[model samples]
Target: MKIEIWSDVMCPFCYIGKNNFEKALEKLPFKDEVEVEWKSFQLDPTLHPDETKTTFEYFKEKKGVPETQARQMIGQVSQMGKNSGIEFNFENAIITNTFSAHKLLHLAKKYNIADKMEEALFIAHFIDGKNVGNIDTLIALAESLGIDKNGAQQALTSEEFNDDVQKDFSEAKNHGISGVPFFILNGKYSVSGAQPVEFFTGALQQTYDETVSPLKSLSGNENSCDADGCSI
Candidate 1:
């Protein structure tokens, strides 16, 4: 089974959803049979590179909300993140373009380290107060994850995975995904938001039973009769 997740690195719910999905997978019967793919989705594409706007300020200015309300909203989200074991420091988080970061994730996928890279990028921005949009910081973080720094640097500087990232984004649009943390189970069922672990476990089990199981041939034949058994 393949599970594709479309999310943004800076999105709090994406981090939480990642943890929730992992937790659910831990108890899944076919956990080892599952392949997870991370897709790219930018919440704000037009953000300037040099912009130093905090998350609260960006939401306040873009949504026309008062600063106080924006802070409260951030606090609420931060508390929710704490419940999921993520330390979110929205006050120090800088809103910038994530196109490059998404491209890096594409490269990470090739090395089979996409999940770790995604988690590191999220922590760098939301918790560690690092600029994930910066090439230097990204290279350091990738190196820490055992990725070749030179290769990572070249990948970031060059347009290596630009087309691939855009393809993921286009696919998200085709799937009518308007938010981050969207999970597509077995490329058929779609679940949005940071759903609970039970939701993920149930979906995984249901998909496995309906599509991946060997007994699927017995699904729609209530009146059928076999050589050894007969039913009305």
Candidate 2:
């Protein structure tokens, strides 16, 4: 089974959803045969890379809500993260463009380490509160993953994986996905949002049965005759 996840590095729900999805996979018998691909999506593509603002301020400004309301919303999401076993320190999280981070992810995809890169980015942005938009931060992450530092830097600084990142965005738009943490299982079934682990487990089980199972009979075979025998 192939699972494609469209997510943003800075999106808190994306991180939580990833954890839930992985847990669901662990419950499956064919977990080892499952292939996962991380697709890039920016929640704030128009935001400047150099612009530094705390997540609270960004939410307050973008949503035109009171600071109190913004914090309340963030608090809810933080609790959700906790439920998913993710410590989201939105207080220290900086709001910055993630295009460069997405580029670095594409570079990691070449080496089949994109999943690790995605997790590192999530930890950096949500827990460690590092500026994922920073080139140096991305380079350090790639280096930590045993990826070539120079290549990672080059990919971030240049337009090397720009197309691949943009293609993901285009694909999302074409698929009518207007949100983060969208999961497409086997390219046929999709689950939106940071749903519960049970939701993912059910989807995985159903999709696996529908696709991998050998037969899908409309009616019972009790009245039918086969080469071996017929029903009495």
Q: Which candidate's TM-score is highest?
A: 2
Local accuracy of candidate 2 as per-residue lDDT tens digits, 67-151: 8988888899999999999878888998899999999999999999999999999999988989999999999999999998888
TM-score for each candidate, following the candidate numbering: 0.91, 0.93
Where is the poorest 10-residue window by lDDT in model 2? 212-221
Q: Model 1 over residues 107-141: C-alpha lDDT tens digits?
A: 89999999999988998989888888898988998
> What lDDT score goes with residue 72 in model 1?
88
**Per-candidate count of clashing residue pairs (backbone under 3 Å):** 0, 0
Would you list the C-alpha lDDT of every candidate in the order shown? 0.88, 0.91
Q: How many residue pairs of model 2 clash at the backbone? A: 0
RMSD of each: 3.1, 2.4
Itemize residue pairs with steric clashes in candidate 2: none
Q: Which candidate number would show the highest lDDT if scored against the true structure?
A: 2
Model 1 TM-score relative to the real fold: 0.91
